[model samples]
Target: MKSNVGSVDRIIRILVGVVLIALAVTNVIGWWGWLGLIPLITGLVGFCPLYPMLGLSTCPLKKRQ
Candidate 1:
């Protein structure tokens, strides 16, 4: 898939996902926190499936010659 997620977006997603997972592992949150895997995978992959459906993209546009 094309990388619709930019650097900053990816970083934020990774951080949020990590936090959620950490909380889950620490038993500070419910099992739902395991859902954090979603963002983590997407961020690592640099693509968001929802972004396509929503017609959104954080990637910088390529310059045309």
Candidate 2:
């Protein structure tokens, strides 16, 4: 799949994911925090499934001939 996540967005997602996971691991939040894996994986992969469905993309447009 194409990467729809731009650099800044990717960073934010990674941070948020790590924070949530950390919170969960430290028992600061509920097990639901484990769901952070979604954003973490998406961020690492640079692709968000919902982005395509929502018609949103932070990635720069590619040049066309």
Candidate 3:
């Protein structure tokens, strides 16, 4: 898949995902926190399946010659 997530977006997603996972592991959020893995994976992969459906992207545009 094309990388629709930019550097900052990816960083934020990864951070949030990690926080959620941590909360889940500590039982502060219960099983729902495990869902954080979805963001973590998407961020790491630089792709968001939902963005395509929404026709949105955070990636920077490439310069044309």
Candidate 4:
């Protein structure tokens, strides 16, 4: 993938994912917290399949070498 997720976006996703997983594991929240996996995976992969379908992109244009 061509890194569809920007740096800031990736950081946010990672933070949110960590929080959700912590909440779930600690039982501070419901199993719904597992939904955080979506962002976690997408952030790690650097590609969001839904981006094109929704016409959204946070990534900056790459500089040509």
Tens digits of lDDT, candidate 3, 1-65: 78999999999999999999999999998999999999999999999999999999999999999
Candidate 1 lDDT tens digits, 1-65 = 88999999999999999999999999999899999999999999999999999999999999999
Clashes of 2: 0
61: Cα error in model 2, Å? 1.4
Q: What is the Cα-based TM-score of model 4?
A: 0.87
Poorest 10 consecutive residues by lDDT, candidate 2: 35-44
The superposed Cα distance between candidate 2 and the true structure at residue 50, in angstroms, equals 0.5
TM-scores, all models, native as reference: 0.96, 0.93, 0.96, 0.87
Model 1 TM-score (2 dp): 0.96
Which regions of candidate 3 are displaced past 4 Å?
Answer: none
What lDDT tens digits, residue by residue, belong to model 2 across residues 4-43?
Answer: 9999999999999999999999999989999999999999
How many residue pairs clash (N, CA or C atoms closer than 3 angstroms) in each of the candidate models, in the order given? 0, 0, 0, 0
List per-prediction Cα lDDT, in the order shown.
0.96, 0.96, 0.96, 0.86
